[model samples]
Each structure stands twice: as C-alpha cells, then as structure tokens.
Target: MIDLKSAPELKALEPKLNQFFDLAKTKITAIDAEYDNSKGSPVFTVEGKYTTRGWTEWTEGFRYGISVLHFDATGDESSLKSGRDQTVSKMATHVSHIGVHDHGFNNLSTYGNLRRLMLEGRIPDNEWEKNFYELAIKVSGAVQAARWTERQGGGFIHSFNGPHSLFVDTIRSCRILMVAHRLGHVLMGEGDKPINLLERALQHIESTAKYSVFYGEGRDSYDERGRTTHEAIFNTKDGAYRCPNSQQGYTGFSTWTRGQAWAIVGFAEELELLKEFSDEELAPFGGRSEIEAMMLKAATATADHCIENTPVCGIPYWDTGAPKLHLLGDYMDRPADPYNAYEPVDSSAAAISAQGMLRLGHYLMAKGDSAVAEKYIDAGLKMSDSLFAEPYLSTDPKHHGLILHSIYHEPNGWDHKPESGKAAYGESSMWGDYHAMELAVYLQRLIKKAPYYTFFA
Candidate 1:
C-alpha cells in the first residue's frame, strides 16, 4: 500500500514544482525550436530526443497545450503565444475530427487549457479569442460524441478500433462532451435530431463504469476490484456485450497501469464536474447522488488498487501482468525499478493518476470525508514527490522530454530499448510530458491558493 505517513504537504513541494517548471521551460522550448513538426506530432523520446509515432494525430494538442499550461504556471507570454498560435493554426482539424476517440485529449489540452486560462484571468480576456476556444470545445465534444455505439444498457463513445470497441481511455476524453454540454451544445444527428451531449457523456461514463472497470464481483476468474481492461468488445450486429480485451496491456485479465490511471483520473474528474451541474440538469441522466455513487465507486476502487499494486514510490510497471514481473520477486515491496532488465516503469501513469488521486481526495473532502480523503491526497502527493525528483524528471538539456521512463506501446515493441538492456526505459511521451506539466501546475495552484484547476474552469 502507498505509505501516506510521510507524504509531503503541498506547500513543501513548491520549490520542487518550481524546479520542474524551470526544467520544463528549457525542454519545452528545445522541442519547439528543434522538433520537426512536418514529420508528425512528437510522440515519445528516442535516446533522449523527441520522435514521432504514426498512430492517430492524438498528441498534437499536448504539444501546444504544454505551452499554454506553462504560461498558466509562470506567465510566460512567449509560451502562451506558442500555444495560442499553434492551436489556431494546427488544431482546427482536431475539432472536426471524426476518426479517433481522443477529442478531449487533443482539443481539451490546447483549446480547453487556453479557455480555462482566459476564464481565470491568467490571460487577457478577448471576446473573439474566447469565443474561438469555446466553439472549438463545443464542436470537439459533439464530434467525439458522434462516435457512439448503442448497447442494451446504454451506449459509449467507441474507440478508433471501430464502433464495436470501447476504450477505457475515452473516459477521460469524455470530458470534451461534458464541457460542450455545459456550453449548451448538442450533437445534431440525422433528421436534425438534437442529441444531448450530457446524456451521451453520462451514458458513456456508465458504460465504461460497467464494462471497463471490474468490481471484484466474480465477473471472471481474473476479476478484481479496480482492475481495468484497456478495451471492451461488443457485438455490433445486435449490440450485445462480448468480452474484455487489451491493446496495450499484457491481457484483458491483467490491469494495464496506464489504463488504470485513466480510470482513476477520469472518474474522479467526472465526479468533480458533476458539481457544476444543477440537480435539475442532472435529473435526466441520474440524480446527483446516483451519479456520484457510480463515479466514486470506480474512482476509489482504482485508487485503492493502485496503492496496493504500485511500488512504494507509487510508480508502476507498464502492466500488472507483464510476464517478467515475477522475475523480480516481491517487486511491489520496494521502489519501482525503471532500470530493471525485466520490465519498464511508467512514470506517465503515475503523473496522470496523481492528479486523479488528488482530485478524488479533494472531492471527498468537500463532502466531509476527511479521513478517507487523506489517503488519496497523500498518495497523490507521494507520487508527486517521486515523479518530480531524479531518475524520473529529465534534467538533461539535450533531452526534449520532461519526464523519463514513459512507455507508449510495450506490446508492439514501439518504445526505445537501451542497447545495453532488454527492456525499454528512459523514454518520455507527449501525453506523459503534458500531464507532468499539468500535474506540476495543479500542485502549484494549490500552494498559491489559486482558483482550483479544472478543464471546465
């Protein structure tokens, strides 16, 4: 379990957060200066240099979003200019993109962060600029919602794998839909039917909560509470539920730690987003109590599982059931070994999940659940301390990555393996770098008592 006994308070981590932003400013600027955008979106690091991965163009937003977030943290007008200009120049396709389940990841990071900064008065409020960002968000949410698959219970936004596949990662991405709903937008379907974005988002959330997350209720022999299957398969012909599957993990039965992180953060963020909706607005989906219960169940379960399965430092290997994990006997009893010849640790997961844990903790505290909330809050802080320090934080001036040891696709052997080692390590990804910066800014906000950070805000 995560040892919360000595987790550093938010104030204590300010200097380290400051140090991270310093390193980040250098790395972000270098990537912007030297990275060849014509090649494609910079996905991950190869030998400490940024490289492109030819998946979807899912990471382009993070590229610009990092700068927007840096500006939020340090008032770097240059960074803000980069973020704003690139987002305007490069992100229009993403708003209307109908090919992938990453609208939230792509649009929310760039457009959403820019919008949030304007609302917070971190940026000068210009009505035209603000409208541009909000319209992008609204359209992005609707576009994301259009990729839906109906089932007996409800429906979910399908993954790029097609209408039959639902990915757990989309749970976090579902926020675009929620944000659009808040912006009074809807998906206009066939015959000009107005599809409710909030309803679609809620259905997607419920579908994910049901199939993607396991609750230790004997759903299968491998069923364990908080265990997340990366993908959930369905029979599209009749919309019948099929089985669990994985694109990035060891297997459907084993938890991929990053997918688990997505669940933890996705559900926690959704829980907080619910507070923005009035009871009347939420009544059609489910009452606030019911919605909170479902989200809380998933969030806390995954958070608990993370604490139980992760190393003392709170970082986890790429997957819980990576075949070679057994070679390192009782690995969870010690700090994670990114240098281990057997497996690679994913600092990106820790960075993403740390924010989830923190958000969940704060949400619970708002509900007067202090004792239980501290566990998650401290666990998040523990992850922050580990992620902000050596072996994880990249200090090398030549490296374009902000955080080290992020795995993109271990199953496909897509990560950069060291010449001396059998496993891939010492890499950073666009999502990983973006989230690390986001997490750092999140902590800094808490320290300064700034307006609470949220995508909707």
Candidate 2:
C-alpha cells in the first residue's frame, strides 16, 4: 500500500539512473581484479572489499550481465565491450555445466541478455555474433533441463544439492528454458529423447507454485498463502515428494526473504512471456490462458506478501520473522534501517523484489486490472524512489558494491560486520547489482516508449 502520488515518473528519474549507472561502472571496475573464476562466482561484498564466494557458482553471469545492461541503459561502449568479452571468455563453461543447477542464472543473464539485445537490434546485426549467443543460450537451457528430478507430477530443475532438492531460486533461472524454446531448441535427455524446453519451463513453474508457495488453506501447519520455503526435498529414486527444507534461511518453517522475492519475479516474468503466444502455440502445455492464470496467481500472491511484509520504504529484512525485529518495536511502519546492528536489512531482496512487483504490475495493467496493478506498481516505485537516495545508493567511488545493505548469508557468519562502529552502511551484491540495473532499464524503456523490457521477448 504505497502512495502512488509519491513515486516519480521514469522521465524524472533519468538523472538518478544515469548517475547510478556511472557509479556502477566505477564499482565494477574496482572489483575486476578480485574476480577469481576458480573460486566460484563473486557472491556479495564483505566489508567493502570484493572477494570470491563459494556458493552455487551461479553468480558469474550476473557479473558480466550487469555490465551489458549498463551498456544498454547508458550506451557506454566500454561496458558493452566488457560484458561481451567476458561472456565469451568466462561464461562459455557455464552453458555446458551439467553438475550444477544454475544454468538459468549463469546463462540467461550473460548469454540470454546478449541474445535479447541482438534480437532488438541494439547490437550490430551480425549473423555470426547472433548465432554465437544463440548457441550458448540453447546449450545452457538444455543443460539446465538435463539436471532434472522427475516426480509424479511435473518435475523440477534440481538444485545444486543433488537430485533430491528443488530450490525456489531456480524458478528465476527457468528463463533459460523460455529463451531456448523461442529459438526452437529442445533438451536431449535419456536415450537421446528430445524434451520440450517450454514444457519443462511450464512444469517447473507449476511445481514451484505447488511446493514453494503456500495457499493459506492449511496445506501444512506452517502454510500461509504467499509464504515460501527456500527449498523442497524429494526422493531421488521414485521422485516421491519428501518435505519442506531450507538451506539458507533461519529454519525450514521461516520464509527466507530472497526466496520469497524469487517467486515474485519468476512468475511475473513467465506471465509476460506466456502472453506473447497465441492459444495454439501454448495448447501443447495446457493452453496459454490457464497457464497464464496460474502464473498470475502465484505472482500476485507473492507480490501481495511482499507489499504487506515490506516496510513503508518498500524494503524487507533478511528474514520475514527475523528474531531480533522485536527489539525495534513497531519497525514495519517505517523504512528498514540497514544500520541496525541487531538485525541487518537486505537491500538486495528489495532490489530484486521491486522489479518483480513492477513486472506483475505491468502485466496486470495490460490485462485490465489497473487498480490492483497500480498497488504493486506503486510499491515498486516506492522502492525505486528510496533505493536511489542516501544510505541506499552507493555514491562512493572506492566502494565495491552498487546497491548497499545486501546480506549474502547472515546465518553462517558470512557477511561483514564492522567491529562495533567503524562506518559500514552501503554494501552491494552481484545479483542485486544486476537486477537493480535490469529494473532501472525496465522503467527507462517504458518512459521512452520503446519495446517493453521482457525476458522472453
């Protein structure tokens, strides 16, 4: 429930967007040396210094993805060259990676974004260049689909945690499937059987809706509509569903904020993609209308939750029920104070979630649901308005992160906590940096009335 009147138009935010992208260039340049390919992708900043993180190795594409996005937004040739060169040099391995479940994140942001630009004619119309990006994306999607854990219903893209685990995060990664499907590619599975990328993507979306999102109808004791679990486990042998679990949250029962945000963006994005197809094109996978309806349900529920849970400034804590929030009595009515040492706020979550909110808002508006769409759209704008201001935007040249107050893994003692009082306010993350820029680009395109920003198109 943000005040729509309070949010500025995209045209008015151009200066801020330009400034942020300029600063983004500086910070990325600062971290170029610390990016170590062997140590997995750079996860998040720790104490204002860039360092390698060993998580899923899924964030490397974002490292280059953000640069490409910056180029698209600012027309900076340096950023464009940087993004293209890195994708060619550092991102090829990710497209063929079979051992991990991050093909969507690694490939989509790098190869997918590159291909999208070329399709839009933002890049030079070179057949060889376009084919190179297309091949990478096609391979990446197939590889992602290859790492599947089949179940009784539609299966899911397995997590990095082996065949038994399906992560809510992978929902966002499913865009790789959408891209490959558009390019007329299929995943080759057992006995060289061809698997439909669209079918797999749709199935994964439905599976995520089932296990990741709660319906408030007592599916379980902890079930509440819009609530999400970070991960869900299943039997690898028979694909029998096991139980709800979390690898990064405080507990299995608590909603990890980022995981919640993933559902918001993933479903909204799919809804947009599905809208492009006619009834016949989508009939093979349950008709475009039904699938779009299901996706809208998932996206709207999560967007509602984010709106309710987020503070007035439209940001959330690392966890919805972070134990320490009781200390700051009546905290939700105002902005999330990331400086609170008792419990750190996750700006990264807000950054990612805001974009999803905007996408859902736009989709809803397109479908003639303006009032509801306005709520989510204003909520998204409130976040963008706040994020561009002091203590959120990283204006410093020496700083390594673009958007500040992103906690990578707080439970494992993974984030940097400046000893007592040393001046640690603005921090950034690779995912946050990438998504925020993507979000900015989305808004910017709308203001210019250009081709709407969509992952599938």
lDDT of each: 0.92, 0.82
Once fitted onto the true fold, the runs of candidate 1 whose alpha carbons sit more than 4 angstroms away are none
In the range 62-99, model 2's lDDT, one tens digit per residue, is: 89999889888888888889889999998888888888
User: Residue 305 in candidate 1 has what lDDT?
Assistant: 93
The top-ranked prediction according to lDDT is 1
Steric clash pairs (candidate 1): none
Off by over 4 Å in 2: 1-5, 33-40, 421-425
Candidate 2 CA-lDDT value? 0.82
TM-score of each: 0.99, 0.95
How close is each model in CA RMSD to the real structure? 0.8, 2.0
What are the per-model numbers of colliding residue pairs?
0, 2
Quote the positional error of residue 49 for candidate 1 in Å: 1.1
Tens digits of lDDT, candidate 1, 1-457:
5667768888999988999989888987898899998999889989998889888999999989999999999999989899999999999999999999999999999999998888888888999989999999999999999998999879999999999999999998899999998899999999999999999999999999999999999999999999999999999989899999999998999999999999999999999988888999899877899988999999999999999889888888999989999999989888898888899899999999999999999999999999999999999999999999989989898889999999999999999998665678888999999999999999998999988999889
